[model samples]
Target: MRDTNFLIENNAKAIWHPMAHPADMRARPPKVMMRGSGVHVSDIEGRTLLDAVAGLWNVNLGYSCDPIKRAISEQMDALPYYSGFRGTSTGPSIQLAYELAEWFEPEGMVRSFFTSGGSDSVETALRLARQYWKIKGQSDRTKFLALKRGYHGTHFGAASVNGNANFRRNYEPLLPGVFHIPAPWTYRNPFNETDPAKLAELCAAALADEIEFQGGDTIAAFIMEPVLGAGGVIVPHESFMKLVREICDKHGILMISDEVVTGFGRTGAWSGARLWGVKPDMMTIAKAITSGYFPLGATLIGEKMAEVFEADKSGLASIGHGYTYSGHPVGCAAGIAALAETRRLRLNENAAARGSELRQALLALQSRHPIVGDVRGQGLMAALELVEDQTTKKPLDKAKMADVAAATYEADVMIRVSGNNIILSPPLIVSAADVEKIAVALDVGLLSAV
Candidate 1:
């Protein structure tokens, strides 16, 4: 029995993958990923896959980077784990926090808090918002509002604040007092209006109306993604986000920007909040923090909010929340190294250049394929929306779209499919030649699907 077969059999017999049924997986064993280098990953069968989605939109530095690997190794040898409690912190942890804060201050960000991952980071933001109001004597201010079709994380608090109904279907009893508003998907145009400024005003007014209807005094925060990620890679007009900021300010609701997918060169900028100029009270980041070299996430709480946490009304009872691995030494080390490498290589500038070329290439695909209804986004983060009829703007049947994605998986490239929207978040290190290869394979896959 070969090692590959042995590994597959053991995986089938023992492991349970996320979002998969065990019975079905037994028949069709999972792909055995063995190694990765640059922008490509290889399976045990010696097949290489172009990771267009950046290994769940985190592998910004791609795989097998010597610097990040070396940092992690050195940290593990020195000290691998630590708790964020007891008023004690490690060097890597403190340095990483300082670096993150510096990156945000120039963009008007004030302070930040750390967390284990995106879900917890978002939860941290929500909790801070509630606490801020509580300390200010607004006990009734507890409700939250989010945008529809957004993907924030999978935790209970995150799901309660998230707008996607599919994610909340199974769990009936969720954290109450969270509301959802229309997303900024201009393609679908739920408001049934164009004219950028008018659209922005309408959307902003709707949010204000919702806040007023709920009683602005009762709402603590409004959470959203500047440019939605899993919610079909939808990009909003510049004025729309600005309008949202104004609305949040009017209602005194803290705006928490969930940039888990759009941070770190995904949108040709360090943070989507910076590019759009919609500064949030708190920012939840993950995915590219360590370039997928390790599992780490952080929640950046701005100065205004940090002040509330710093007052320490309760000597020992101040912000009684923490994770065993909140700032794991190894993860912090990787983060420090990753940020340095990003600056050294100017990856954000690279994203700006490649993203323009990639978007053009994707739009060109629409010219060749009628199914391609829309090609939109910035930097390496982009999406191609499929439609049954371009005139009607009807989405391809959900089941049909899944079939299309499964078929596309057989090709050389690995792309992420969200309903009729095919997402593309290729590694920042991808070159022009790599982009062309991906385009050719994706073109064939789209044609075959149609």
Candidate 2:
């Protein structure tokens, strides 16, 4: 067995984790994961911990999945890599696209374009929105809008369109012409109303006003997460999404749903867009697409937008798009297997069932812990907003919350905290019992911190 000190030292010397301060991390020397199985992971010391965030909101099939492994192995042996250019395609790439198009039908129009990951896929959507409007003879429509606190990804275009302060603030002067409006967070409603309908109107009207102020002709599209994942797992009011859809339609703005975190059974449906019955003009998907078994993301376009490209078939006007590893064979194979596994096991139904149990348990904790300001979510994705006072709904100290989150990791339950809110997005394969253990671990950590 490898020496524990050696492993920790090596990781500290070489590896850099996302969203972590390297200096402070050296003192703790990050937990080195040796292996994972089902909903648990083992460190170098053979200590097991329940995986609550599902490996950064992917790994929907849990760890050590045999089917996905076999599928990937078979494809790698046959043809591991290929380009989707010049009329060439691989088996898994073709099959998975067709399957997903069929699955997400009736709610959103569809056609798939592959990328290496979520950020790239989101960039593709933003660029496509501009190009589609151009093809429709509306070249002035170049501006893009997203909700505040929304996290699309880290790429230039995606980051610009994303509304996360920390993600964009450091990297200033992001892509020009991107705008942001208030998110539909009912808990701390900007409208100062508790009613869902009023809150929905308040949020959608904010977007409408922004579009009008900027001149509708200059705005290309509006992108948003159906259930704000990284942004505190904020679920929109009941009628909010529909109103957003109506506003987009009225202004001829293409709707791009960034379902990177909420897609593929995360919200007890094939896509959260389907759960809410919102017909987006386009979709950017990743995460559970391959259950984190491989790096893959896709941009799904509506039929109306596809026709614009279809009409430009004359090879004269260029579409200037594509990644070197666009339709990777192994990633596609993993995606196919992941989708098949999710369907066969009825993972969406499981998420809804387990999520219901999680809600009740979390709400019960609210009665006991004032630090848990609010509990909100749908299906398997959820959040516990930590607060200083329950009555005033004052958020806990940001640094203190981060400390609590870091401590929870030591407790052997990997839960993520976004801006004072403990975000829990376990794998779709997570069982009811696993949910209970995760919640209990979180409670212990929070109480200890308080």
TM-score of each: 0.95, 0.96
lDDT of 1: 0.83
Q: What is the model-wide C-alpha lDDT for candidate 2?
A: 0.86
Estimate, for each residue in 116-222, the C-alpha lDDT of model 1 and write its tens digit: 78888888888878888878778899999998888888889999887888778788679999998887777776888756567767778889889989999999999
Question: Residues 230-317, candidate 2, lDDT per residue (tens digit)?
Answer: 8888888768788889999999999998889888888887787888889999999988988999999999988888777888865523
Clashes of each: 4, 0
List the global CA lDDT of all models: 0.83, 0.86
